[model samples]
Target: MLPGVVGTIQATEAVKLLLGIGEPLIGRLLTYDALGMRFREVRLRRDPKCPLCGTAPTITDLAVHRNGAGGACDVSPDGHPEGVAAAVAPKAGG
Candidate 1:
């Protein structure tokens, strides 16, 4: 949800709510397996250019590419070799 929006609950609030009911999960790692069962926490990284929560300028849209072999790349807003379709495609009938 957009920050500062009315009636929008923040992540901190959500965590607090869970903790209030004896389900405190702060600092506790959580993970899911291929069967969708809770497992353990794994290492993760924060993208400096993530549109949702990054230091770079916000991006309105994102383009995704894959090689059908589990390999993928996340393109940024700026035009780059990895950004094949950063901008929206023109309407075909327009």
Candidate 2:
């Protein structure tokens, strides 16, 4: 039953995103417990004073937070194409 409900909600959100309609669960955390058969939603809100996406954001450059440790993507230890699939894709697209 829990899986059924979760799948239904996931499908519903997918359709909503495709059509750009309905209020999606963007600002809420939904949880379900199978044994209890309970569903709960916790409202989420952004901090107004935070630098990122705030009224007066100061952090404009994202390079400061970029993880340059892995400067370049390379093949996995095993040298398998499928294993390095993630390394092939860029972190962020253009």
What overall lDDT goes with each candidate model? 0.43, 0.62
lDDT of 1: 0.43
Cα lDDT tens digits, model 1, 1-94, are 2233212334555767867854434444343343554345433345456655567745444533234533334443462333213333323331
Candidate 1, residue 62: lDDT: 50
* Candidate 1 segments whose C-alpha is farther than 4 A from its true place: 1-29, 34-38, 60-94
Give the runs in model 2 whose Cα sits over 4 Å from its true position.
1-11, 67-94
TM-score of each: 0.29, 0.47
Error of 1 at 34 (Å): 7.6
At residue 76, candidate 2 shows an lDDT of 38
At residue 73, give the lDDT of candidate 1. 43
CA RMSD, predictions in order: 14.2, 13.4
- Candidate 2 per-residue lDDT over residues 1-94, each given as its tens digit: 6568778988999999899999998877576667887887766566454455667765566643565735433323353223223433323411
